[model samples]
Target: MIIFLRRKMSRSKECLMKYNSKKALLVTGERKLKNTSEKLFSELKVSPFYLNQLSEVLPFLSRENVDIIIFGSDTYQTQKETFSELLQTVSLNYPQSESIILARENDVPFVVSVLKFGSTHYIKYPVGIKELQSLMKSAMATQPAISPRLEKEPGKDSSRFGLIMGKSTKMQQVYAQMRHAAMTDIPVLLIGETGTGKDLAAQTIHQQSERSAQEYLPVNLGSLPNELVASELFGHEKGSFTGATHQHIGVFERATEGTVFLDEIDSVDEKVQISLLRLLEQKKFNRLGGKKTIKTDARIIAASNENLEELLRKGQFRQDLYYRLDVFRITMPPLREKIEDIPMLIEDFLTRFNKLFNKKVKKLDPECLEVLQAYNWPGNVRELKNIIQRAVLLAEGDRLYIHNLPPRLQKTRRSAHSISFRIGTPLDQIEKEVIKETLALTHNNRTQAAKLLGITRRALYNKLNKHKLK
Candidate 1:
């Protein structure tokens, strides 16, 4: 009993020691920023130190160990040269410590410039606590030094990687991560909203990997029936079920020593997840109705349009399976986040569709481009491609015009009058005004007004009589 007590105490001490080892330093003079840093560091359970001036940073850092350094953009803007010097010093003297900058969204160009000086990452200003917490945690966990930072060579194009195209800083960051994932054989998880080029990213990772020589198979799990997902992933023996008249070979078996890209992995049911977990853990799985465990050397790259972490929290996804695939995770930025790359993307799409359709569309009208740029792309690059394809087919001359675009995109500005009411406006009064406007728009047609108001003609007549509109 005494021995057990001593061993438990020793284990607790070791755990405490490990937790205390991670330290962060914040160099800022702003009070709000200092308060935010305190709250963030406290939540992360990381020891933090602060300094008001840049001069004390190196001296303090040299005396103590710090794992993260965050420079305030407010102060960093004034002392750009000094900040650059400090970044160099940190990179050369403390390569293990990652540096981050807190800047506004408009400062992307400046952030991109500083990234070349060995800075690890940047966080946009006015970030919510939850969003900032996630970013800092990911930054703390990653080793940016080992991640490949691919730059444009003198003769090579840097705007594109494999089939993925973009020159924005966000896409460049993604490209670096893709290169990092390609260098290893570990399972990778690609997370993003739909139409974010996740499929392209998966194919790129495989093409850049050593498994390029082998076959690359892509499976859209969402498109398959839930009952057959396991069978499709792991081959079934003859006479295993009613449909199994002959032996079947699955992606894992056929893609041996290659790459298997699993799209919409979140749709996989719990039964299939169990088999996936086992395959990831042991690199082997049993075929349906077969007793033998077959070994596979294929690399797994899973992607999802939904947030798998959220699914795990809701108990919809298996925790073990999520972690198994999250060993190396890459997030593809939404089209809205990388809007700067849209013009280039538009050009590429136009070129492709022009040749295929045998059109001579040379350029987009300035007004049309403006409409496209101003609109929020919910469907992302895929949506833009579809729009361009349609426009090319409709365009009659050498240049595409605003009229050729979809009605949703053709309207550069909305002319509809916005109705505003005071906080104390009576509900009846507001309803009267809405009804009046509806009747005016319908040119005094009571039936049309009733339909527009989502009410029957009798109710409209009663209201009109009560309000004396008749």
Candidate 2:
């Protein structure tokens, strides 16, 4: 009987061991991604530990047999090298474990490039909870039997690339174009408003392309002086001009085998345009005051806030040069066009600033978010980021209140007088009226109206019927 009891105990221990080995995941990020990931984890019935840095949870990773890892883009901040180091270490220590990176769509290419250095996959953020759950399950089921070779050599620094952050359908279309552009060596022209992240899009394409290993050099044509534009782009020979005290290599030469991003390309003078056109066609150019024709194999990616075609019509920009750079074109949409993405962006920026300023802001008050949604972001994503950062710094408590926002934003807040009402307005009638108004403003889109109401689709539908407006 004692022998039988010993065998039963052994069987029970084995079952407990197997149970302990099953791990869902751990999500590391600042506040934004942490909250999102937590919601996803809860919906999927998976437990996730949130940490600002990998180092803080290094013991957990070492002790727990985590099945999957979800890392946020904020892990790559200037001061935090631990995340990258942890990625390398995790690959070496737990070769069989599956790792996935979560990042904004614009940063997907950059994140993928970096994670690929460690043989990992990257997932774009603001991902649906169901989609995330599906991805995690798929990852677990298809765990690679063998480890892939690390592409990046040790001791080599990966080039810094720009990031684009949005998950809305409109932004998804832009992402598709970017990915298609990344597959080739074509010259791309990106036209967008000042704060729409034209530079970021250019960098993302370069990072996702075959030339990602090469250098990426950016030159702001608008910032250059006419007298110095040629010298800066084509370099200068010793004693070539007044300030030519030493030999210099231009952006084209420096960016060989990579990409040269010319911002405000419309600002280049006619002479510079001719030079640029020649380089684009012949891939060859001469230094200032030098006879030697140097060859460069750099991919050109140019951006402009102005309408190049209109500029061409007005004789401000060259028609031929415009065609040369327009082999592939991607236009970034203004923030107002994709307002549904504002919540995701706000969350991302909050997490970023939370880490930067070492604050633990928990949430943005519903009224504050409502005010933000109502206002038009004329400056696009950049302006939104700046505003959120400022608000976080000035915020008093855990939650970000409307009064904590800038004067401009506070002034835009809805006043009591602005609230709509009728003498016999029922609660349900009021809800339907608000929904109808929002839907009309959103062009009869239920999803957008639901977002504005801060409720799920089912909730919106239920409310629509309760008011007999279905």
Candidate 3:
């Protein structure tokens, strides 16, 4: 009993040693930032130390084994040369503390410069807790002294490691979730509006999964006839149905040792949902007419544009199957939800279409882009891809003009608004106003406004109601 007690105490000590809170130092000139920093660092469970100036940073850094140093842009920009010298001095003297620059959204060029000079990732302003945690976890969890401090080269592959190109926060969250989901064979349900690239996400998941080398079959439940849905999904024997002339392989059986993406799974009848429940629960299913049981190791990735919960309430979907597929569900933002990625998506689609049609359309008319940004995308990325393809094919000059687009695309004129900050404005009020203005700019489009504000739609909704900004 004493031996067991000793072993338990040793284990507890080891855990306590591993649980050492990371130390972080914030060097900023403003007192207001201290409160915000305190809240953030407290949430992260880090030991935070503060200094008013960069000059005082070195002494503290050399004494305390600080894991990271955050330099506020407001102060860093004031004395760029001095701060740069301080960072260089620390790099030479301390050789351990990872340096990070706090930046407002507009400081991209400055951010690029500092990144080259050996600072870590920029923690953008209006730093939500999640973004801070994501960035800091990525920074603090790694070798604080060794990793390269620069972003990757621009000429990355089209789908960079199964990631569709867009550095927008919304897309980044999706990428993070997808990457997390890919590491497991547990069922993943992709919830997104139609044409928001749910299938693309599913394909990426399959490609990134352990089953990458095997077949990936995507069956559209919405397109399949109600009568043939079962036979199509679970296979059929010869003479099983009026048109069943030969034994057939189903998607589930064919996708053994691989993945089967069920697009528009929300549309499947309750009967199909029952079959799905068994497949999800047991990983086993029988053919439509055969007696023999078939087992599969195939991963199921179900996607639905509609709300599955609403369907459950309406008796249109199975609650059991819904819960089963909801294991690691990721919500895909609509194109309008990530309108900031419009240009990136356009560039990708334009390059492909230009090569396909042998057209050299170089750029989009600036006004045309504005029209696109202002318009709400009902059909999402698929719609935008089609528009870009048609524009590339029809565009005769180096630029894609508004006239080349359909009448609906050419319409929608929203008065653009500018967002600016006053010195004495409360940060909370500033945030509220920014949300309100972005909504107005998007013409009351919460999705587009959320994209513009670098926040989730749900977060935007909460803030809107919180601030009572209609």
**Per-residue lDDT of 1-470 in model 1, one digit per residue for the tens?**
00000000111223324433677888888999889888989999988899888888877865776767887777677777887777766654454466777777777577667676553677777666676677666655553222212222233565898889998767877876776677568889999888999999999988876678898999999999988988899989999988899999999999999999999999998999999999998899989999998999999999999978899999999998998999888999877666568789988988999998999888987767756765667798889899999999888998988789899776543334237799999999998898887676444767646755778779999999888897
lDDT of 3 by residue, 151-218 (tens): 11234322343646666667766765665566567889999888888888899888766578899999
Query: lDDT for every model?
Result: 0.77, 0.72, 0.74
Error of 2 at 215 (Å): 0.4
Q: Single out the weakest 10-residue window by summed lDDT for candidate 1.
A: 1-10
Cα miss at 227, model 3 (Å)?
A: 1.1
TM-score rank order? 3, 1, 2
Relative to the unseen true structure, what is the C-alpha lDDT of residue 284 in candidate 1, on a scale of 0 to 100?
99
lDDT-best of 1 and 3:
1
For candidate 2, lDDT tens digit of each residue in 1-470? 00000000111223333443435555555676666777777766666655566666556655555656777666665433566666765654454456777777676555655554333666677666666667776655544332112122233222212378776656756765665566567888998998999989988888876678899988998998899989888898999999789998998888878999999998888999999999999999999989999999999999999988889889998889989999888999988767778888888888999999888887898888877776667788889889999989987778899888888878765452145697888886777678887765545657656877789879989988777775
Candidate 3 lDDT at 312 equals 85
Best by TM-score: 3
TM-score of 3: 0.62
RMSD of 3: 13.7
